[model samples]
Target: MRFGIGFVGFACLAASGAFAKGSIDIGRAVYVERTREGVRELEPATSLKAGDKVVLVVEWRAQSPDRRFTVQSAVPRDLAFQRAGSDAIEVSTDGGRNWGELGTLRIGSRLASAEDVTHLRLRVVGRQRGRMTFSAVVR
Candidate 1:
């Protein structure tokens, strides 16, 4: 299955328009682009493979920005969660129902690894292979 980055067409993350007087806006883009000093451009992803590393860049802008924000994204079952360097992440193992830190997560009595995470809550996010949607609110 394939997912679109700019709208609600795909089961992955849906990108919606700016909200509430347009003071704050959120945008989503998935790319296969790696962070390299020599790499000038990031390629957008049209499809995903088994072990592809995707960079999910969520853009947030506001006339007056808040000190903090809580961003949530819905993860597709096909993609496994990967670790980003941010410290403000809470992950869910049981769909989007419950969320916990990496150490606190479990699946049927086994502790969750960085690889077993399903959903990611953070300032920025990454994944293995699946559809995803991102949402954020200024705090």
Candidate 2:
């Protein structure tokens, strides 16, 4: 009876971990051009130390029609940041599992400019030791 219970407990823990990894689809497509006009992935090649902060900027041109877009970011395990506006641009510290409002920048319309730049700032927590990935979606 003891062995059976232990086996089930271990199985449950393993399953939970597998489920968490499966929840993330890092396989999502990435753009391969210099136009800066598609879903882009941003992250540091090396793991970040705690209390470290990095500025991530996304530059793109939204074609006319003035539509709303959603940007999703997956914060790596053990990092946190305060998001500042809208869904068009967002920030996350938990590996993209959850996101908070960061800020917003207009995309399409006469008001759009080729030189417009959108910025998101993220602070890395020392307690966390892993790579964080960010994704931006423009529709």
Candidate 3:
């Protein structure tokens, strides 16, 4: 599965459309940790497989200062989210519409765990650029 990070879709983090001429560009890269010939290395996941330790790197740059917008990225269907770099990040189990803390979110009667997370939400504000890294294991 591909890392299809949802940079194209912007949601409301706090205040939206405050800037008239700001642009955001996102870049995604996937790498798998592996060992070969008694050496450890990270290689492009050309042949993704189950149980592979994968890292999803997301980088974004905002052209204007003090731009507040939402950025969301979906966890690949073949991967299970382990964690992201931010403790203040939000997780969406039901797509990107609804989001909350992982253990606090409920899917019906059950609590939504990291395994149930379908997308990750990060609010971008008070900065011109940022990077987010997520660790996951392919399922």
- The C-alpha TM-scores of every prediction are 0.60, 0.26, 0.77
Higher-scoring candidate on lDDT, 2 or 3:
3
Error of 3 at 13 (Å): 16
* Per-model CA lDDT versus the true structure: 0.53, 0.28, 0.71
Off by over 4 Å in 1: 1-23, 33-42, 67-69, 123-139
Q: Indicate the TM-score of model 3.
A: 0.77
Among the numbered candidates, top lDDT falls to: 3
Q: Give the number of colliding residue pairs in candidate 1.
A: 5
Which is the winner by lDDT between candidate 1 and candidate 2? 1
Instruction: Please identify which of the two predictions, 1 or 3, would achieve the higher TM-score against the true structure.
Output: 3
lDDT of 3 by residue, 89-139 (tens): 788889777978878899999998888988886888887888777788878
lDDT of 2 by residue, 39-118 (tens): 54444313233343332222222232232233233322232333332333443332334444432233443332212223
lDDT of 3 at 118: 82
lDDT, residue 19, candidate 1: 37
Clashing pairs in 3: none
Clash-forming residue pairs, model 1: 12-131, 12-132, 13-132, 13-133, 79-129
Clashing pairs in 2: 50-125, 50-126, 74-95, 74-96, 75-95, 75-96, 84-102, 85-102, 85-103
